[model samples]
Target: MAGGLVAGYVLGKLYLLLANRLRDHTVSIVMQFVATFLVWILGEQLGLSPIITVVVYALTIARVLPLRGEAWLRVQRYAVWDVVILVLNVLAFVLIGLQLRLSLPQLEGPNGRI
Candidate 1:
């Protein structure tokens, strides 16, 4: 956990630095997405919680500073990410439902241990 926190902080700072250096809005957004994956994967590989690492990195970005860009670019980013999030949400829910279905038959009647 300590390692995750420290690594998350460092990763957050790295993301901010990289974002500041990138000139293209499209590339910057893509880089941010890639950075998220990298951070999570590295955190897991280092025996840390990938979920916490990603959340910490995101909260740092959200709370520390805002990235300003062209109005058009902002709109595009919103639209794209909106769909991405929706799809992910749906997939997650579907996977949960599928898992429950697959496990239900193995469950015995009344007071069976799940």
Candidate 2:
């Protein structure tokens, strides 16, 4: 998963560097989709979880571009709903992580002994 994420990040950065003529939004979306799809396909082929693959892809995409700063400022200026969705996504992940942790069962040795 980590390896996939690193690869995606590197690839995304390279894509951005190479595709200098494209708009930032277009580049970001294309890179994100490509990275996510590749990770998903690789994970499925390797018998790993697709959800984890997508998460790693998302992290890579986040690291590749300006999620903040000038680009973000421009986005905010035009699309407040995008920021709302981003915030909601962050909250959703936090809740999902908490729920997963909370639902974990305590482990014990065989014969019901710890």
Which ten-residue region of model 2 has the weakest summed lDDT? 60-69
lDDT of 1 at 12: 91
Candidate 2 lDDT by residue in tens digits, 1-114: 676555545555655564454456655455445655776786677666666656755565456445433666446434654665798899999999998777654555566654
At residue 1, give the lDDT of candidate 2.
62
lDDT of 2: 0.59
Please state the error at residue 77 of candidate 2 in Å: 12
> Runs in model 1 with CA error above 4 Å?
65-67, 108-114
| Candidate 2: pairs in clash | none
- Candidate 2 stretches with Cα past 4 Å from truth are 1-24, 67-114
lDDT, candidates in the order shown: 0.81, 0.59
